[model samples]
Target: MNLLRPFSLLLAGLSLAASVSASAAERIPVVASFSILGDIVANVGGERIAVTTLVGPDEDAHVFQPAPDDIKAVSRAKLVVVNGLGFEGWMERLAQSANYRGAIVTASAGIKARERADDDHDEHGHEGHDHHHGKDDPHAWQDPQNVIVYARNVAAALARLDPAGADAYRKNGEAYVAKVQALDSWAAQQFAQIPEAKRRVITSHDAFEYFGARYKVRFLAAQGVSTDSEPSAREMAGLIRQIKAEKIKALFFENMANPKLLQQIAREAGVTAGGKLYADALSKAGGPAPDYLSLMRYNVGQLLEKIRLN
Candidate 1:
């Protein structure tokens, strides 16, 4: 109750407040282009980073238009991460507009990109209509091997941003990479169980080209790389014919894609729709595909179950 005791207590409170402020300031602020990449950053950055995802879970980044709030996120970020192979078309403009002077990391860097032609299929009479991503496909994260690259790049970028946390970032990245490796092996075994003839699938769009390439499955799609574009009538007719001719077993649509086109193709082709895939985005927290590991495992399990049922 003495005046001197109260003055000392006030000084102590101010010191505690300053310490808390410093601790909060130490955390690296990161901005990720989408949910899938944000999950990767969280794993690699761990508690050392606070991530802001421009396009969040169950959201489509392919046609994502940046809002004004995104600029504020970018302006404060110490690091900006994106899937570089032409995936986030709005990212560059957003960063430029925000005057973000931070390090931009391409999570897909160093992976051997699959060419757009690799996923291109005939659209019957629609000669000009094709699923294209310039020269390279941007869905490399579909393959776990490519995600290993993403983890490494993220770790390196975080190390640069927060040198004191380099060891922790690298350790976390290695642990996550181990999980991805295990998933890749498990996927291979699952795919091997299915005969080559039974590996063909029809999806809502060309989002699974990298998945098909890695797993040795063939994916036929009605729409192009970007879900924003509607498939032409002739294009849908051609895909329907192909599915019927090939006796395709499984037809799946992405979580963010409109199911109507895939459903139409399935109905016309006389095959039941397969399970929904988490292609462009992750599922919500506590959901089946909350992270990269769960997403891959969930997708493979769905494909295996659906394809085998046919």
Candidate 2:
């Protein structure tokens, strides 16, 4: 009865598909080193960017091995963003392999870097030998205030690349910065409710020094800064003694780290392991800590709930 209707529908579908392709083509291609940084870039760039994250959710970037697809993504990107501060030791090699000529933006560019110290050393005073990234603790993103700087940096970089979208980028960056500031204020208030003596925590690695400094909470780790570093038996023994003597009860495993080590520590110290903290990466899309803002809130909430037990 309506033989022409099917042909008309097919033509309309093709037009819609072409429109979508054009829209995607108009967006700038951006490559982020990890999921958390990719989320920040997405917030800052908004609809103007198509972001490709090399390190997916809950994946370790410290020992990440880029595949051929990653190289292609980098090569095709108009811009690439990294956490910097030695967090991406493999980034340089990957870029070389990709022959990426685009600008690489360091989100933590202007922030004052935290230098690795005794926090990276175990109880027996053994330091991490993998200081290939130097003495800087690459986990600056642990601090929400630092992320404000990250938003600003990403905005500036994107503005430089896509000058036409400068206003949009700035507005987006400002909005993101406001959200981060609010988060920082809330976190400060939350920590204020806890006594100074109960603010101490134990984790698998020294990835929270920035967070510790920001919130004034001390973090003791079983291993050093990098996850690749193994703790000596003497070091673990010393840590166990300290945990027992100090009665520290807030122990957590990072999302990207091996939980076995922290689990063993908890068992030895006779303390129940708390919920996992998002340190180096975000959780999956459906998980609690899917983005940077959510990640911080989840971590702070978890820490508060558990540290109260100390």
Candidate 3:
């Protein structure tokens, strides 16, 4: 009787494992261009979809190169979501290479995109910087309000692909949007505590234009809209001068960008370098900014803490 009991228990465990595997295999497959967008889609899709993120956490998407595995993932996906606004310049080529003919959803479709300004010219009036993206700055996710739009777009896309899960997607998306709205309100209140004049910040790149516009903060960066370009010597010198003259003490480094240039500028300007900010990507799992909501809160806390020193 004891031997028979052990055999039955082993058979039951194997049956449960097989059932779980089949349930997971039945989920809809979706691919997101990067981690931040992936997290948003995951929240919207919930258990109905399986998401594959190409550019991972703490990785730079500005210079991301698609691998063979990425092509395979895209080819197998039912829907592909991208940030749009020319953010993922490599997406089209990757899709072509993968022979993907599925629905490609633009997460930033309905939001008002910020245009790229030619604010990098030196005193000589020469074009001192180069931009890799289109006329719009593609970092709309920086603002939680914009992410509300993103969540809706993703939910709509998922519903079209899986009509049976429409109500579920809608409910999930609305819940996520409410959280985002709350984050935005909290952020606005936090920023209001500091005087407008003390809301200036410096970073390695111009990835926070949307955040700056949303919160009424001024963000000055060493590079242009894209992080691929290097600032000219004259341009760098001008920024250092402004940092010193303005006594901007809230200098920060981006998580995905090389910190060498910003560190050099900080040393030359005699200002201490502040903590890292999650600009283009989220932190790895178990880190400070693992998901979208956590990313916004962590960044707001860091900014407020350092800007107070200004």
Candidate 4:
């Protein structure tokens, strides 16, 4: 070959090597919108992906202010998973700001929603409102039945990203869904022991619409689904009035909200502040409720025991 041709081939080889080096140096960074989503991604992604959470455990994502490091994580992530139900309003802003090009997987898509309480009894505009009041509740996984859908959604998304681990992700999802079904059966069995009249519960936030709807329990709350939205004074007053009228036995606090509100509500309503609950996020690795399975068991089991005692 000619000398110039040999030199040109050498330069091309060097350029290719540099590109491969840069690409190989990058890890498959994954970002989750919040702690619960992060936990789900971790289960499905396993060790193949490096996962980061914009909002950590017990943080209200509705009001979360993501940090610089959090932004960096998202910017570098190859995939971003979110529980979309207008839950993470800031996600779009952050993703755009970071200029991330990752695939977005919304775990809540295709889930059957519960009607919002606001629309439940609003005679003012009752005719044609959808599940926002009639059918669309964002907290589907609270019902283990809905978590099966979440698992399938998560598995499909992860498989699309990394086809190599598709088998593992699928198996993990199925196994997890089976566990969720078991938990659902267990929760129903535990709650069944309670008298129908005593199935009423009071929580700090309205996070249990799905749980209540699925298990046929009544979850009266002092606040709405998100702690970020402050309850109107009239709303709070009305809740307190209803609690007293109903003789609601227990008043549990969400791990995410300001406990002061629930504490005040409990004191005003003349009910002892009840057990701690994991509504918004999984408890840290070794606290009261650890993983998803343990977390659900602890929450439902505690409620069962307390409702009986009260």
Candidate 5:
């Protein structure tokens, strides 16, 4: 009945316009392939981006099966980030299927990957599923220097997606790098404290090659990089023999992975069971290793703690 209320109508129009503008201004939606990518994205993107991870911390990304939801997420992402270098084998197909048009950034773009253990042919004379970090060890983040490259790539990608927030991403990435550098220093310092001979470790898997290379730790594994591959009984016997011969101080288990094999090895080797280490994924929020930084810190700390005690 109040058809003449022009002021009220004008006020409603302005309110609706403001709401629409706010909704449109919401930060760009970003999706990272895995936890490491997600962590870098969160650090660089900060609160201006909505970051989602496909394989969360502590979950194995190598054998990860991309769910339908992940495909949809990638299809809708503003900028999709992956470690690339063949890390996510399913990623290429998913991206192709989704027809995602956004920039797909390879965080390891500048990284020089490590050589595959068996650079030869598979049993079938074809390519083997075994890898050296997706051909170059997408786990390059294990090396702090490589992490610098990752942060830079992430910042650059975010800047491309949302130019207005580029400065924030760069600033945050630099600050986060400082923190990572500190962690690197602390990890090195911890290893420095242990005697060179005692620095040897036997892990459930080969996830720590970069870390070992960086920190002077000797990590021997019965199996290859991924725990998915089962080590033969002969391989286990050989490992057990080597462990006894070397007198390796402790045997370690990955938290996110099954510890049964490591436990069996420990029992057979007659050594103390070292504490859990975070390798593939980060621990859940309530657990010790929740984030990338904390995960690194906790793993090294626990390794040191157990080695020192034994």
Candidate 6:
């Protein structure tokens, strides 16, 4: 009960508090190239990481131009997440300019990319890039199986950055994988309801080839892999002719693509524009698709409803 004993105890407590504060301040800062990957990082990283999404929800990353703030964000981050496979045409330049020395994790690391099979190719076509560094299709996230790879990459990256949060990230990654599995199962059941031949639909761009390959839905578009590429008159007319010949049930626009192009196509093709699809980007919060799971569900549901044979 000496007064000196109490003073010494209080000093030790203060030192411990300071140590805890310093550790907490070291929280890893992460920058994701786009919204979909941002959500994936958030789900896996949880509270241990601070995430900044360069391209926001319902925004197109195909034609995204990084601002000064984006460079600053990348420069300050300990981890920068990109879809890689040449998805972000501007990301390499931006990262180099910012001198981002931290770990640049390619979320689509292990997935095998699908090659573009279209004969009429445009400049933005996904021809040369593969899963990690090739010009293969960059829309791998459209298939949920590939997203499992993405979640694992994110968890492993977070673990590497902050070992203390490794267990938490692993648990989150496992849970997200389960959710994706369930979603994939649900999608299969829904697709089974429709006849295979009637699964074709037209959208604004060629962003859904991976989705089509996985889900058995055939997506036709006037533009190539990159939405920034312009639709040629011959391509549009050819798509319209194909739509008329196939009697394609529905035409749709993506959240990122201009609806006017699809509207004109629909008019010429004698089809109505279906509900907007979440292709390159997700819908805003409180909208049809606010997260990865919701985005897949919404797209699948819309396809089932619109493309079903009457």
| Candidate topping lDDT | 3
CA lDDT scores, all candidates in order:
0.85, 0.91, 0.92, 0.76, 0.78, 0.84
The Cα error of candidate 4 at residue 197, in Å, is: 1.6
Q: Which stretches of candidate 5 lie over 4 Å from their true place?
A: 1-25, 117-135
Give per-residue CA lDDT, model 2, range 12-82, as digits (tens).
99999999999989999999999999999999999999999999999988888999999999999999999
Candidate 6 vs. true structure, TM-score = 0.87
What's the CA error at residue 303 for candidate 2, in Å? 0.3
Output the TM-score of candidate 1: 0.90
How much lDDT does candidate 2 score? Answer: 0.91
Better of 1 and 3 by lDDT: 3
Runs in model 1 deviating more than 4 A are: 1-22, 118-120, 123-132
Better of 1 and 3 by TM-score: 3
Q: Write the per-residue lDDT of candidate 1 for residues 1-310, one digit (tens) a residue.
A: 5879988999999999999888878878999999999999999998888999999889988778898999999999989999998888788799999999988999998999987643256533334344335777799999999999999999998898789999999999999999999999989998998887788777887788899989888777777677887877777788778777777778898998889888887888788898899999999998889987899899999888877755
Please report how far candidate 4 places residue 294 from its true position, in Å. Answer: 1.4
Would you estimate the TM-scores of all the predictions?
0.90, 0.94, 0.95, 0.84, 0.86, 0.87
Q: What digit string (tens of lDDT, one per residue) describes model 5 on residues 1-310?
A: 7877998999999999998778656968889988866887798888888888999877888788878888888887898898876677788788888888878899989888865543321221222345535555556777888888899889998888788988999999999899889989888887887787677788887778788789877677755766677776767777788778877766888876788898898899888778888887778788887788888888888778766643
Report per-prediction Cα RMSD to one decimal. Answer: 3.2, 2.0, 1.8, 8.3, 5.4, 5.2
Candidate 1: what lDDT?
0.85
- On lDDT, who's better, 3 or 4? 3
Off by over 4 Å in 4: 1-27, 119-136
Q: How many pairs of residues collide in each model?
A: 0, 0, 0, 5, 5, 7
**Could you arrange the candidates by TM-score from highest to lowest?**
3, 2, 1, 6, 5, 4
